[model samples]
Target: MPRGTDHRPRYEQVAAELREQILTGDLAPGAQLPSTAQLMARFDAANATIQRALKSLKDEGFLNSRVGKGVYVRNQPPLVIDTGAYLPPDGSFSYELIDVETLSPPADVAAALGLADGEEAVRRRRILLHDGQPLELSASYYPADIAANTALSKPGKIKGGAPKVLAGLGLPQRAFVDRVSARPPTREEVEMLDLPVRTPVIRQLRVVLSDDDRPVEASVLVKGAHLYELQFRRLVSDPEANDV
Candidate 1:
């Protein structure tokens, strides 16, 4: 912890040490980090180096500075998302209904939902919360004809989720297709998610097909990639194992 002990820049050395501590869970989520004075003393580094080290972690999304509160480790444990599963996979999550409106679906969304050109769809937008922090943005598109006068079109939380709503309309989803990608977050997404600049997001485009193979629903989810992981359960055939 002496100044210039390592050939690397003092700030990088300090940042590297702190980064390891966070990755190793020595500093747990919401744990307040050491004060600048403490870090400077421990590292034998100047104020500028100590400040730069803290800023590095902040830009990496490992730490956040509160206006009144001191710097603390961000509660960014990866959320486990089951592909094609119902929203709020567990009870620990809180959700907010951002918007529900009839709008001209984006070109790709319209195609996924099997809507014609210029055709409108009911768009339902919701955001999921964990520990009172936003974790995901989900938007589902339903063909106007399919959603009219149903719970899907209503501007309120659906009692049984989208699947149940479709089931009520005699169009239960028999299968779903999901395609995932990642990209830099937009300005609006940065604000909505309270994410660090330059952070990338995971995008999952899902299409739900009815029993007759009709694409009844399509949804686009933008998730905090740094703070989430996707999990899937697969069943593989092993007929030989059945022989006894």
Candidate 2:
């Protein structure tokens, strides 16, 4: 990935460069950034441009200023949620099951799960906790045909989580397609995640697929932008993937 390929402004280009370094661990958390003069020399950017770039990172929760001290990468590592590790950690963390019921899913969820209009789904809402602090709010949906006679349709917690239960039903999850975005949290989400302010939240819509790309589950997740990061990798080595 070359910086010259991006047509964004110079400051955004610079910020993107630094942001990649941070994300790829070229610059570790809490690492002190190079001096502005040094950065200016590196990016061939003016003082104002450099400051704007740094400010962008600050606004995005990527860096923090110490006044007397120069800006440093945020100390707390973002909770990593990848494809295989999408579920909350079982042993290291805990969660609260807010509600479980068979109800009509949202439009997007119904579409993702291949449900027809007016088709009901099993809705399971939960809140994940880390170190006794609310970390994320998740709402999962399953089609009635798939969840019937299963723990998912019940009004109690499912042992070993929903994935395991689905597996037992011979509809094991094989892959995930995640759509990530950011927006204002709802009143319920704010209270559930215990957000101190009305800051924008990172939201993800994840569709879990079984064999033949059959979607078995769809989940909507909302979390504090300051609390988590999403990582992805591609197997294709070129622009075209033969088996993507």
Candidate 3:
């Protein structure tokens, strides 16, 4: 055991330490870990405890074991979500339409769509899949008036995605704002995403604005916390002034 005051269980502490190493590339992808006996000696723990730690990491997709060789770090790369664009999923991804209906949305979503109290909105619920794995659970809301009689109110994918549909209706998407947070996955989320137990979820509430600053769409996007990372890039407004 390394000298420290982390009060977690010994196995959990060992798992956390090894997880950090894997994430930081200290344990490179495909690199085999030390032998079980070496790990037990290094952590000053019993062989069973070391095995338990390895099992935890393996369950989390950080490590893999060979039948006769050894445990090695898995070559898994976290998905990078670019925050500045509304790019549609490429060929490797697909959308599974869960449902479409008109209903009064949550308060925050209502506010985002500028809906009046009790005013209904059309919601398109979908599961975004990347190479057949669930990547995100998304629910996009549209003002009832704007969505009525359109594909957005129906129960199938919109050709070219919602942006194109909105554009065809003369409400071309101009910009979007996202508010992101992370918390424990809801029961439904855990089931839908097939997330590991206790894995948190990252939620992004995105509001899309059209011409004349009209709020045309709002979506609630949720992804497993461990599977993706958000990327944001902004230009320095005063680069000259920032010179050190």
Candidate number of the best lDDT: 3
Residue lDDT tens for model 1, 26-132: 99878999888899899999999999888877887788998877999988654677885756556778779999999998888888888878889999999888778
| Angstrom error at residue 162, model 1 | 1.7
Q: Could you give the candidate ranking by lDDT, starting with the highest?
A: 3, 2, 1
Which residue runs does candidate 2 get wrong by more than 4 Å?
1-74, 88-91, 237-244
Between candidates 1 and 2, the one scoring higher on TM-score is 1
Tell me the tens digit of each residue's lDDT in model 3 across 1-244. Answer: 6887778789988988898888778999889999998999899999889998998888777789999999999987666779775444578877798999999999999999999998999999999888898879999999999999998898877888888889999999998889999999989999999887667899999999998899999999999976777887877999899889
TM per model?
0.71, 0.68, 0.88
lDDT of 2 by residue, 84-158 (tens): 565655676877898988889999999999898889999998888877888888899999998988899887788
Candidate 2 residue pairs in clash (backbone atoms < 3 Å): none
Q: Model 1: how far is 113 from its true place, Å? A: 1.5
> Is 2 or 3 the stronger prediction by TM-score?
3
How many clashes show up per model?
Answer: 0, 0, 1
Q: Pick the candidate with the highest TM-score.
A: 3
- The lDDT per prediction is 0.85, 0.85, 0.88
Residue 144 miss distance in model 3 (angstroms)? 1.2
